[model samples]
Target: MKLANKRPFVTTLFLRPILLLLTLIGNYTGICKKLNVAAAELVEAKAVCATRLRLRLRQAQATATCIVTLIVLIFAGAGTAVSVQAITPNQAIDGLQQLAAQAEENGSIRVLVQLDLPFRAEGELETDAAVQAQQANIDGLQNMVLEQMADTNTAVIATFKYIPYLALELDAAALETLAALPAVVAIEEDIPVPPALSSSIPVIGADAAWSVGYTGAGQTVAILDTGVDTNHAAFTTGGNRIVAQGCYSTTNASYSATTVCPGGVEEATGAGTGVDCTAVVGPTNSKAQSDCGHGTHVASIAAGDDGGSIVGVAPDANIIAIQIFSLFNSTTYCGGFSNCVLTFTSDQILGLEHVYELRNSYNIASVNMSLGGGQYFATCDSDSRKAAIDNLRAVGIATVIASGNDGYRDSIGAPSCISSAISVGATDDVDNVASFSNIAPFIDLVAPGVSIFAAVPGGAGTKQGTSMATPHVAGAWALFKQAVPTASVDEALAAFQAGAVLVDDNRSGGVETDLARLNINNAINSYVTGLSVAVTASEDYLLPDDLVEFTVQITNNTGSVASQVVLTAPIPQPLSLDAALLSGDAAVVDGQIVWTTGQTLNPGQSLTRTVSFVVKN
Candidate 1:
């Protein structure tokens, strides 16, 4: 074929050395035996006498470039060309056909067909009319595929709009025919991703914030996971703390539609009285409630209040359970056993969309997605899930995600890898990085995740993963928002990062050897301008009528010194402090031990004092 444009000198300069090397490599060994025919053909075709080659080069220099242009096109289309190279189907489609042949006795195999499409910003398509038009285009494309498949008596099982894709069930003959279609970019079998499978609140200093009365009260953190058990005491006071609930997983089959919860109301005011959406049902005989207790644990970790035994980081914060995963029958072997699939990307996208939709009514402060999969070394801005997160964040909601449990450098997964999401890694009680936490530059903070105690479906339990680490950060964000009502998402994230205490661990196999562990007290203290106090008892377990020693440390962390610093400790019943030992304007007022320092503490300065008390019978 004649070349369209000619740059003979430039083309020759680049291709001459490549052609020469290939010719030498081809002659020494039968390169054709090792190389694909396309590469071998080019090397063999360009083989000619030195004089003839020079003559052709000189001729091309005067007229046009053909050989180099053809070579460039061939390599460029090697793996990605769906239409141009479909005369010989691409590797992806070829693999599908092979799979079909292997499973011929089982009939057709299901595959996802990813199509190539131009990028269109969601904002540009924000108007109702615009959205409808874009959806119409997607539907039209899907209909075209369905019609084409009809010729072979095949059909599309599902269509994905967020991205131009379709799931289809086809035989070998039908798969080959579909592969030849110009619209098809790739065809691959649906791969099942298993669930990646938490914390003490005090190690993170959340207890300090609680002492100061910033308990995430009135804020709501939406959790997108398996499904929460609203009946759990952690999620209920007199009424359920779960303000809203929805199921986006397709495992139940009936709940496949993302419109609303199947068999459950969209919203409810109390526990067990709310939505009863269908539980996830996989072929492996799994249920969200019975088989997967992840969501309840995650929810409790973020906002549960079980009379203090298993208090969440944000004990009083409301919860919105957006169930995105349910147990499904596993089509492939899972860890040598047949376990149900845990989640899907489409379900996650739908859950995110629902969160965005409910943002206004619930005033969602943060979104806790303690679930992730798929390794993405860099930020995944192009994924639809990332887009959904960005959309929510644009409106002032913070998205907190778990760095994957892959334990590899640069292995943070999507949604979490998105720049807008606060990606969290796991740390143990001693502030050591968890061995399984994925480390990368994207990780925003670390939290107590190893053997974390939280509420599960049937009361409470302990679990571990970066999944556990994520909710701690999410709850911290809610606390920050409650403390600083005007803080934006960026401001909240920065405060949290600034408050993180750096931890050392060998588990970080990546360039980042140390991670910043979340410190909620520091995070809240960073935004407040005043003296902050942290109190501790010499003994945690004190018997009634026993002498108790308490130490209080007050620090002025603001830009200026805190004058007239007054430290007040509320004395509850069964506790009495010795008045004679009190010093420096110390007095007992309204059943509280008040120390009026009347002293100026300079910035970054701290003062410590010990007070003796006796437990009353």
Candidate 2:
């Protein structure tokens, strides 16, 4: 459960038998090829492998089964048939029954224990005093849990303020005792969240947002990744944009490399805490194991402003960099790689917890986490990180994450799979879904991620993935926050979706998805702010070829002048525009009338333009 820590019952009892069966089949094939044996002696074998995948019910203690069938193999060794035996694990993956099974198999387990008490969103508590009182209640519950498990070999691995849960390492007796308690709601394995893996400003219309003065000035975007190169030119071109830094890398002896934080500590904060992780992290065969610039690349894509050469989406937005990954060595944990980058869910949670704490101090609009592991089709609202995400959302902070780079047509990765989190997939410059992008109905949006040029640890570099795509949205959110300071996370997201272009992904053999490709310029223009527009017509009903006069009135409600005003009225097939009646400077383009007002609209000012159209069948 804790980074390759669990060795279940089936592995101990039935592993050898399955291995022997596979060995015979493999050896027989090689021998026949080398010895020129009779082809008939090695005949085809079709197998409906009876692999029992078990899952235990939470409170009912019942068993649910699934099967993995392996078919079509060339069997028969020594002119005799060779059988394949599959040994399936007792895959107890939920609640108390899982805890019991894990205990019986491994003597102890690591888990995220969810308590019965519901945690309130930040918005639910209207006042700071109310929030403090709620914190007191949560702290009391945590204290009670510690007291209950004091007698057993139980250790609290991590405690969270935003989420009502605890990461604990406990023996089977302790787990059972805790489950029996009335406060305990359910439990799940504390799974390892590994690193899943940018680009252009103009493709997403960031330039338009910038021209209109929404350059994300005074806003802070949090980047939780491997770590950033704070001294890189990408962060310090216009100004010293890196405002804050923190590190929360996990190091488990079984699966993780040495601690990546400064001084080799598990967690640290302040200057130099979030620098690049330059140690060798990949396998020995890897040519660039020492290159750990994922966070640096991700940060620059979100808000890095390096003169003009490699600017990110929010060129002027400040950054709060935090390190949240560790080097994992175990092949089981590293997806068969001898060494690779992975992060513990506990560390990521803590990193988010730290971000929540800094919310009051910084004008934080969003947190960018371009990291994930494992794919899911539906919302993973039950993930331990969801509590933190929900809490952040309640206070207007959005958590934007990568949908993953697994190329799944119908699923996305976890953390991003959480409903409250804004999951993003990758798209190329031409607006097609990237081949490596994980797609699903749950994906929130898509952004340009192919061949993205951004900041690496040393200098500007090129890379691409859903990881690159995510920062575009994060930076766009920062711009939204700057443009409309009072906008909530939901409002900003809705605005983005409102102007997003739905791009269809029809790759591979899976259900196709039409996901929203980010349109920052349109989203900003369409979002309600200081300006409001209204339309009226001369006639409510009209017959074919009837003349109808329509008018659009623009009003500025803000105290200051609204500059760079532009408007477009889409023309339907049934409507015919009378060019003679068109208002000043208004021209039709691609089935729409476009108008660009060079002047600014002052406070309480209104502008109206009238045009005539004919209704056609």
Candidate 3:
């Protein structure tokens, strides 16, 4: 046979070094016997080797094989020595496997089942008759069964079984125990923080101007909605202010044919979470993000300050971005279904927890929840939402909730109807309640929520919604908190109510029903004018049928100071104060005093002495 043309031995030259390394490894490992066997095969493959050379190669291979065999023996002995010292099994490995198989055949048990038991009894029990007697006396005791199983000196068997399809049986008791487990880091109630709004007119008159006074500066307000563009001017305060509270994006990981995440909503520059609907360019872009820009727009309107257009109700507020729902489509569709509403309960719950954690950890005082669920079959009493609201209240946090946009009457959805929140209804620029804003007894007040101009994400234009109504209130609450450092939650709520302009219908009724309803301009023009009044005790103890003596002192603090104050006390039975004893120029001005006692007790003055009194006990 003719030999194929051969290349130069350059390749073998490179292989020579590798061969040497393998030889060294062989020597160390004592596998030189296998190394020699390979060498013999290599010699046979050489086409030009002479018979003498082949014989020499074979002799060398044989010697190498002997060395390798000795090395193999040495390594085997070492491995055997290590195994013998590490694990001394009572039964051979195969024998144990056979024993397990036999047991499985007899008992219909699985290998996994055997290992699941927490403990196993190897031999006979130790006698303990007294303990068995006591255990048998317990209630619900099956005497015969206990008698048979209670032998202290007997072998016992325990087992674990796998139920079909069920991973484990976690009973109600187990769940309750799990809730109290140390691994359960937290267990809190869900809360509702709805939105607030202002009257459409930019000004609240003079008295009502700072009536809801707030700067919202240095405070963070998280808007858990579609993702926001951090670079927006409305949010960044025209390159001047920026909220330090961190931001996070958690859009859906899974995608559907109708809905795509991180796309859809558009800004003024026309960029948004949506893509071009016309272009079928793969999954890159197809929908518009502007259709449902309610969240971003409301967020900006509540706290935006791009130097112009329309200043937000609270210009210095911070923004927290959360995308629980996609902004890619106006009417969110899913899985080829139109108007497919995917309830984002888990996401909403997480957002609530995140806000709660933020408040507890960082002292975020105010939060606004602009979302609402449709009125379902559940009643307010049965709803579990109170847990969240209560949790928020327990931590001294205030929430603003938007009364739903549903025009339907008497049907306010959860969290808004939740007793602990400030449920806001919508009012138009004309001061008329928005036709779309849902009204209910739970609604704390109404604000400008109709056709409102607010910020959108991605440097976008403004949009409108009752959703915009909430942030306005949150910003105002932040301001109220800032103004009255000593304000309690109840006091703060009172201040809010006392400052709201009384809404009215065209017929002059405080509450309007139709197109004619408007707000009375100065109805809510009161401030936190310092409070002052004097009290007198009529003879510490009252004896039967004796006349009492009493006197009064009063001071003025409504910007000016003058004498003449009036005090009214609601006398409960068994405890009546002499109303006549309420001295000073008793003039009542909207639940307040008109002037000071001596006729001119200036702004900072107080009655120097206490009034005296004697009562008939």
Against the true structure, whose lDDT is highest? 2
Q: Model 2 segments beyond 4 Å from truth?
A: 1-108, 283-291, 508-514, 537-550, 566-599, 611-617
Give the whole-model CA lDDT for all candidates, comma-separated. 0.66, 0.75, 0.43
Number of the candidate with higher TM-score, 1 or 2: 2
Pick out the ten consecutive residues of candidate 1 with the lowest summed lDDT.
Answer: 251-260
Candidate 1 lDDT score relative to the true structure: 0.66
What TM-score fits each model?
0.61, 0.77, 0.47
lDDT (C-alpha) at residue 127 in model 3: 29
- Give candidate 3 regions above 4 Å deviation: 1-214, 238-292, 327-343, 360-363, 376-381, 458-462, 504-617
Quote model 3's TM-score.
0.47
What would the per-residue lDDT of candidate 2 be over residues 85-157, giving only the tens digit for each residue?
6432222235567667776676667788776565788676776655655565566567777877888888777
lDDT by residue for model 3 (458-485), tens: 4555445567666667666555555444
lDDT per residue, candidate 1, 1-617, as tens digits? 23434456457766775676565455534533454546434343233222233433433442324454455564565476633332244453547556677437546665667654443534444554545444455555666667767878465555655446676667777877887665566666643344456238879888878886778998999987766777777877646788887775443232122222454332222333223323443343432234337777888888889785779999989998876654443334244333454555656665677777787787688988886677887886645455567667766788898888988666687668888788888888987778888878767888888998888765788889988888998898888888776677877777776566666556535467446788887776655344467778878777776676767778886665545545544566566656655544567775667676566778899888777666655
lDDT of 1 at 405: 91
The reply for model 1, stretches above 4 Å from the true place, is: 1-190, 251-289, 374-376, 380-384, 484-488, 508-511, 525-617
